[model samples]
Target: MKKTSIETYYELFYRWQRSGLSKAAFADREGISKVSFYAWCKKFETKPDSQDASTGFTRIELAESASQSAVAKISYPSGISVEL
Candidate 1:
């Protein structure tokens, strides 16, 4: 079998979690072996680290006008944006 990158497996794992499908069903739909799918799931099913920089908040550089405003913005690694 051709080796796949961790990112590819990560994406697949994310999709499987969000799909709400049975493991067997998801494996079938994704055209991967159930054994391989399970293995990847186990390998990647780690608790998220609150201190991990990639997922943690970082200092934001705001424009002069925006800095004066009360709202604050947060961006996630998933490309989600929010204002508070």
Candidate 2:
């Protein structure tokens, strides 16, 4: 089998998702081993940088609320902010 690029794997992964087929069925139909398909899924899914953006820790700020309680504020790179 020829080595597949990351973009190809990503395309295949999305195809598999849209096909609504089981991983084993998709792998078999696509002529790839289940292990390899799963590896590609793990590798190309969400990429490292994007994963970091979604799941990585960030600095938090504490602000005084109207009730004199402290509020924890978290900011995301996407210009969204959360207060707790």
Candidate 3:
């Protein structure tokens, strides 16, 4: 087996997500162990310092509404919208 750098692993992670393949299948195609791939993903995802805008997740805070008629909305990048 050959050694892979963290940067390469990160790139593989990104590509795997875009490929829409299962983790096991992607790892097999990439010549890596699925277990290691999953471990790496968990490590990166849970690393406090790794939180950033690029993770495709954001922390949102909503203010408390005094009235029950308040409306809330969510907008997606694909032009989809949801209201509550």
lDDT of each: 0.75, 0.73, 0.78
Instruction: For candidate 1, write residues 1-84 as lDDT tens digits.
Output: 888776677788889999999878999998988998888788666635233223444455655564556776887889999997
**Per-residue lDDT over 34-66 for candidate 3, one digit per residue giving the tens place of the 0 to 100 score:** 998998777666755434424645565678889
Question: In model 2, which range of ten residues has the least summed lDDT?
Answer: 49-58
Q: Which candidate order results from sorting by TM-score in descending order?
A: 1, 3, 2
Please identify model 2 stretches exceeding 4 Å from their true place: 45-84
Q: Output the worst ten-in-a-row residue range by lDDT, candidate 1.
A: 49-58
User: What value of lDDT does candidate 2 attain over all alpha carbons?
Assistant: 0.73
Q: Candidate 2 residues 1-84, lDDT tens each? A: 688766676778879989999889999999877998998777656465333332354444455557866677677889999886
* Alpha-carbon deviation at 9 in model 1, angstroms: 0.7
How does candidate 3 score on lDDT? 0.78
Model 1 superposed RMSD (Cα): 8.9
RMSD of 2: 9.2
Q: Which is the better candidate, 1 or 2, if ranked by TM-score?
A: 1
The clash numbers for all candidates, in the given order, read 0, 0, 0
The CA lDDT at 17 in model 3 is 77
Model 3 segments more than 4 A misplaced: 47-84
